[model samples]
Structure formats: C-alpha cells, structure tokens
Target: MLNLSRLSTSLTKHGAHKIALLIRDHDPDKVLSLLWGKVPGINIEEVQARKNLSAGTTGLTVPSVWKEAKARGSETINALVLIAIIFSHHTLIAAMRQGAKSDFTGRITRDVELDGKAYTNFAHTLEELGYSTKHTQQYVDFDLQRLFKIPDLNSLALTLLALKMKTAGWDGTGDLKQLLIDNGFHEVFATDEDQFEAWLSSGKLTAPSFEDADYFLDAAKDSAPAGKYKFKAGHKTKQTGSVSVKSPLTKKTAQLLHNYIQNKFDEQLVAIHGRDCVGCEVATGLGTSIDVVVETAKLRWFYEIKVGKTLKACIRQAIPQLLEYAYWSAEPVKVDRLVIVAVHKLDKQSETYLQKLRDDFKLPLYYEQFVDA
Candidate 1:
C-alpha cells in the first residue's frame, strides 16, 4: 500500500494539485464543449425570422436568458468543479507510475496536509457514488465514462479530489524531480547528454530538446555521442517467394476459420510457415503450417490448425500437432490460455485428447465446427 499522505504531497509537487485548481477555477461546461468540439457560450436564435434562423446571425440571447433563470437553482458551478477534478485525476494518474515506492521521505508541511484533506474530501464524495480506489487496481476494470450518463461532474470532482491527495506539493512546487531522483532514478534526470535525451524521449519530461541539451551540457558537461540511431525502427517490405503447404483444409477452409476468429475477437491473425514458424515460440518444429496467433491487450493465445480435412487420420494428427504447438507456445508466450478450434464432426479420440490437454496442461481449449456449405 502507498502512503496516501506522502503520495498526495508528491502529486502536489508534480503539478497534479495545480491541475485540480485549474479545473476548479475554469467553467466545466466550457471545458466540456471544447473537449467535445461544441461551441461554447450561450445559445442564440434570430429575433424576427424565428423559423428561418438557425445557429446563424440575426439572433437573440434566448438560451442565455433561460440559462440565467436556472443558473441560481441548479448547482452548475459545483458540477463544473467536480468535472474538472475528475479530468485532472485521470491526467495525473496516467502520466505517473502508480504504486511505486518512495525513495525518500520528507516533512509533511501544512500545504501538503491541505492538499491531502481536499483529496480525501473528494474521494468521500465519490465513495457516495460507485467508483472507488479498488477500481484503480486493474487496467480495464472500469470505464470512467459509464459512471454517469452525462459528463459526470460529480464523479470527476471526486476523482480529482482523490488524486489531489497524491499531488506532490501544496502550491505545485514540491520538488518532483528530486522525489523521482530519490526514488531510485537519480541517473534518470542525470545531466549526461545521452541520458537526458533518453529520459526526454522516455515521455517523462515535456522540456524542449534544445533546452534539455543546453541544460545537460551546462550541468553535466557530458556531450552526447553523434550517431545514426533513432528510437523507432523503419518497416521495409520485400517481394516474397511463392510457397505451398499440403493440408486437408483448402483456402476456403482457412478463410472460414480466419473469418470466425476475426468475428470473435475483431482482429486478424498472422499465419506463418516454414522459417517464419521456426522463430516463433508458438511454432517450434511444425512440418509445414502454424496455428493462428491471437494477441490481445492482456494475453496472447493460439488457435491451432484450420479444419479442412475429413480424414480421421488427418484429424488425429491435429491434436498431437496442436499439443506440440501448445507446448512450444507456452515456452515462448507463457500463454494463459491454449485453445484449439477444429471442424465439428470429430472422432471420439480427438475430443478425449483435447480434454486431456486442457486438464493436464491447464490450457484454455476451444472446439468448434465450421459449415461453409
């Protein structure tokens, strides 16, 4: 568990708290409009040509008048505050490494305490709603937008309040760079030219390249070596040689299985053969073909062997073949799930083998029949 108090102080030091303040001060509706690409300010309509007028010229401030009438009754300001805080919370958490241990501890001054109190208050408000600290544990556990039908200002406010507690400083000057340095990344912000560039490109700091270079040169005095190395690699396409594999499943069968996998997961699987399979841990020493490799956000799994052949002998080969594929796959991917999809009409032995593979190896297996007729 992270020390919420200290984390909040760190957050304040890092500008997370100021971000909350920025949101609280700004009008929520205006921010939402900008985010959603809607025009801000009050709506208006034409005075004389009511039917002819659109959101065009020759209009009166009717929307503003109506809004003004409700402004006193409805808590728009409070709602806006909430929304801003929520956005700020998201921004801060996404940017920082959550749950990291602090390298050093500092005195909790009055300003830090204030930020922490505000964060706690916000969290209390949100706890009244549904979103809690528990939701932060998993990556895809919650969809923030679903908390409320509209912009969810209340939830946003609560989220921001919670995040504010994690802010680095009270007025945004808490020495975040020092905090990181103390936390076992001293060399991260080290003034070495190459190190500075690497940290800059690592997406930590938003400083300009020239400023960063100058600062490192003046501070660290370690000039970076000139080189032709770039962070991202380029892709090159080449003409491929023609090749063929002998299997019961023809192009039509492969197409049907491929379509099935795509419809199920909304992604295309890249099927490789020969040497391509050799390097892939999913396919160690397969004769001519490899299974469809499906990669997802959290896990990677394989759907081995397209079912095209009808022969029992051929069908029998698929299980042992798939078992080998699964074994090889586990070696490389350490796959959480190992699944096999085959044509519907299967001999009893194949089904038994599949069950055994699933039970013994703890692989998530799937058996399905295809009908292209």
Candidate 2:
C-alpha cells in the first residue's frame, strides 16, 4: 500500500529547503529544472553521483558548487518557491528509486499495460498516472513533480489514492482523475487516514528526504558574509500610511527577512512538530494577517515579524497587531504565546520592559531575534 495521508503533516517549507545539498537556492531561471537530470549549474558527474547514492543513507552530499552563481542571479528569490522546488527534487528521487529498485511486485492486478512488458499492477499504476508516458526521464520528472504542490497537499493525496487503489486491484471502474476531483477533497484524505497508516508502520514506503533533518544546514550560512551589506533596491511594497510604518520594506529586504524566519525559526519548530500545523501570512478574520502561526499539541503561537527595526521599535510595532488579531478576531481564538521577532536582540532595558508586560500585565509576550547569516 502507498499511504501518504499524513505525508504533509511534518513537511515544512524550510525543511524542504534542506533536503538536498545539491539543490540550489532556486534561482528563478532554474526553478523549473528541479528534476534530477534537468537542473542547470550541475555537471554530469554530479548527476551520476547522486543517482548512485541510496535512499535514506546518511552522508554529506557532494553537489556542484553554486555559491558564486546565486550572488549573480537576476530574479529576486521567493522563499516559498525555493522550498517548493526543493521538495520537487526529492519527490522525483523517491518515486524513481522505488519504482526502479523496490522489490514489491505489487499485488493489485491491472487492466492496462505499459512498455509492452513489466506489466504488474505497480507498473500499470505508474502508467495510468502518466509516469510511463514517452518512457523518457523527462516525462517521469514531470509526472513526479506533478504529484505534490506545497500548501496544497490534495495532489499528493490523490496520487497516493491512485497508487493504493490500483495496488488493491481496483477494477478501473472510474477515471482516476475524476474520482479525485469529484470527491469531497478534504474528506478524501480524512476518511482514509487510519486505514492506510499500516503502510507507514510496515515500512512499505520510503520516508521523504525532508524527514529527520538532523544534519548541518548552517554551513553555507556560516561562510556567508556578515550583514549590513547593501542590496540594490528592486521593488517597494512597504506598508505605508495608516496601516503600519516605522519600517520600510523593499522587495529584496522583504525576501531576505522572510527567508530568515523560515530558515531559523519556522524550520526548527517544524522539525520537532510538523508542517501542517504551521502557517505563514495567516488571516485572522479581523482584517489583519499574521506573519507566522505555529500550532502544536499543547499551544498556538502568533508571531509578528519585523526587520530593519531596533529591538524597542520592533516590539512596539508588533504588539498592536498581535493583540488585535489574537484577541479580537471574528471568532474565539486561543493564543498560547505572542512572539515579537526582529533582527536585533533586546537590550536589558527592553528585556525588562517585556518581562514587565508578561509578568505584571499578564501578557504572553516574548521576544526572538535573528541576525543575518
């Protein structure tokens, strides 16, 4: 069985970013080339090396150096897109490894055939999913990437549904694509969850590459230049007028600030908990958006992210947004913690003021900081 009902639970945007050392920073030009052999800036030798490495094996990956190139790319980076492509790369590898090397000549019988042979239910399922079309590596890449789109895990659920039903000797009564879109979509993953959890415990499928990210991710960051380095201004969408000022937001700076939050704060929480519980730009129904919202078994936290502000100023601007949305939203909401995130650490005076708010005023406020890498 191919159970992936819980697949998106622990897969975070940042965790995906660290899946493969060979994966680039998602320069916009090469973002579409996330497939194994299709990526630019990598040599044939590097491709073969990655291919030869076994699934789930732990070692420092040796991908081609791409540091200098990222510094020179044209398009400004979107952190979300970067992680999306990272996840795409691993999805391709996982499917190919299993389809090519796994010994499970699957049990379900199929009505279709592919490549004139290798016509087990497994191969047939791949075919019906369009994985066997053209039989070129490119088609396989397309089919695999077509499986999962981050922030929308239904594609993943449908892919898994097709695989499972086909393997269980599905009679081919309905079109696979129609069977998916026609159903109550959330109900689709919900209703089948525990029924397919057995596959997870029995080790029937390989864990995703983003799982158990216990390796070093900060190596490149450690070597990266210390900050105050200037960015050429690109676009400015700074929240001005009455909404929120006190800080200016340029396109590149906004990207960099968001990238920092995802990497430093968001990734750590997700590694311990899961991605399904974390959200960015979360709407609070009170005509406001939160920077990040992380929910766990015991707690739900609302984060307000501010960059280019001093510790005092960041806290000042963040408090109003956090309080207004968390308490006065359209519905009942529980806020376990309120975090003020900035680029600078709090001075003693600022720390004492925050502590006073927490202890004396009974606010669940806290502070977090992330300096440039």
Candidate 3:
C-alpha cells in the first residue's frame, strides 16, 4: 500500500513556490494549452521532469519561494490554482501506481466521474481566456481523464487546499476560501460556509472525509437541475427505520436497565477488590467514543452497553464496537478485558461465538448479561 503520509510529505518537498513560479513564468493560455495537450511541443511529463530538477537543485522551499513571489507582485490565487493542478497530476500518477496492484477500480471510477464534471465546469470558466467550447469539451472527454487517469480538477483543488491546511494551519483570514472561489470552486463555499469551516476546524480531513465530501457534493448536484444547484457543505444525513415510538416507556426502561446493570457491576467490583471502579466515557481518537470504561485495581474493562430485545441482538450490536474500543484505546494492553453488557443472557450461538473469540483467537473479550429489576 502507498503510505499517504509519505506521499503527502513528498508533495510538500516538491515546493509549492516552485510550482507557482512555473505557472507565473508561463502564460495562462500556454499553461492551459499544455494541460489540454494543445501544445504539441510541450507535454506534462517534460514539464514535471523540469519541475523536479528545479525543486531539487534550488535550496528554496515553499515559504521562501512564496515570499519571493509576493515581493515580485505575483498573483497568489493564480499560483495556488496552478499548483493545485500540478499536484492533481502528481496525485493521479501516484494513485494509478498504487491502484495497479489492488482493487481501486470503483474508487477510481467514481473520482473520474465527479472530477470530470468539475473539470468540464472549469473549462467553461477557461472559455473567457480563449478556449473554445469544442476544444474544452474535447480535452475534458479525451485528454483529462485519459491522460491523468484520476478525478476532476475541482476535487483536486479541494484536496490540495486540505493538504495545505493540514501542514500549515488556517489563519481564518478567508484567504483560502477566496482562493477556492476565484478558481471555480464556488460550489464548495457557496452554502453552509460556517458548517464547512467548522468541519475544517475539527481537523478530520482524512482521505475518507474528502471522499465523503465529494460524494455529498455530487449527490446534491445530481438532485438539482443546472443553474439551480445548491451544494450543502457536510455529510448526508443517515437514513433510519420508520419504526414508531408511540410511548417513551421503551426508552425509559432501557435507561433504567442500563443504570441498574452499571451499578451492579460497580458494586460487585468494589465488594471483591475493595476499590471503587471508576466509570468514564473515553474518546478513542478513532472517530468513536467508548460508552463505559471501568478501571479497577488490577484490570481495565472496556464495556459496550446495549439494551436490545434479546441478548443475542445486543451482543451482535456491541461486539464490533467493544473490539474497536479495546483495540484503539490509548493503552490496549492495559485493557485486560472486553465486555458486552446487556439486559438479558446471550443465546447459545452468541455464547459460542464469544467463547471461540476468547479461546481460539485468544481475545480478552466476553459478555456480561444482567437482568432488569
């Protein structure tokens, strides 16, 4: 597998300033022409080779080169956009190499579709700069996907922006937002700006997060007609069953049973060990919060509390969660036991599975079922 961290580091080492210089030095028309394969004499591979040579030989980094560019009154927005384009090409190369040995066909196909649309829209914007519709459409249909073999330009721009934010903290000055808008990414920033900003602030811009965001944007666009599209800047709401909750009795019963079982466990632990068991909800840093963590004198117990109609149902719901909690905890070895606490005893099949996990897999995991008073 391609280590994304190493790839990101390699991209950063390539120096965004040198990329900006390459864009600033060339005419926008020629740059677009080179990108679209209009310039027969200059191809992307030759341009990339030259860029690698310049980046390696020059001692200048992104910050220093950016400073020099600013001194010379270079347009920062254009530079950022052009750098994003270059980064997208490099990312496609890396992704293709990695996908060659694995099953990334579905992901690659989705990226190509979404990014193809974004690239087409971008080409529409470039029409003002002298690209005809025929030429732009031809480039989008033939050269863009065929040559780069990745997603569209807009997502590439977003990914580059996210990488920048990850490496260099956002200043909240709206410069990055403006840069995106100026370069045909108005859809991302058009609506729900505050929500998008909050998401960015949460520091959860993993590869999956970017993919989720892209999926959301694409879905929203598909649901709306052209020129009337409204892009929401967050995840899609999860669909839930339409089961009726006629009364609050079920909820209250579950809550009371949960408390009773927790108290019983605490009392039992204290009576046996002569020390109070500390119960707390712990954040596991893996996008999940452990429901109840009980730390006693000699052992740390990770518990997934569930109140289902049957013990088997509860155990089924809690098994993966309990295992994940135990594995992703700050100190997994310190967690001596993983327990699934429910309101009833497990069925035979559930018991067998738990035993197999404990005996065969040597997992320190088990189930604890408690009766409701």
Which is the leading candidate under lDDT? 3
lDDT of 3 by residue, 1-373 (tens): 1122322222322222233344556543233233334433333443342342223223333333333333434444343344443333434333333222211111222244324544443333223222122333434211121111222323334445655443333443555644443333222222223223323333221121221233324433222222211111111122223322121114344455554455555555445544445443455554444555666556677776665545665666677667755554344545678888765656788888888998998887788765433
Model 3 TM-score, all chains together: 0.31
Tell how far residue 309 is off in model 1, in angstroms: 3.7
Q: Model 1 reaches what TM-score against the true structure?
A: 0.23
Q: Give me the candidate number with maximum TM-score.
A: 2
**lDDT (tens digit, per residue) of candidate 1 on 95-212:** 2223212221111122232245444433433333333333221121111222222333333233333334334333434543333333433221123232222232332222322212
Point out the higher-scoring one by TM-score: 1 or 3.
Answer: 3
Give the CA lDDT, 0 to 100, for residue 148 in model 3.
Answer: 19
Per-residue lDDT value at 183 in model 2: 32
Candidate 3 residue runs with Cα over 4 Å from true position = 1-249, 282-289, 329-333
Better of 1 and 2 by lDDT: 2
RMSD of each: 24.0, 22.3, 21.3
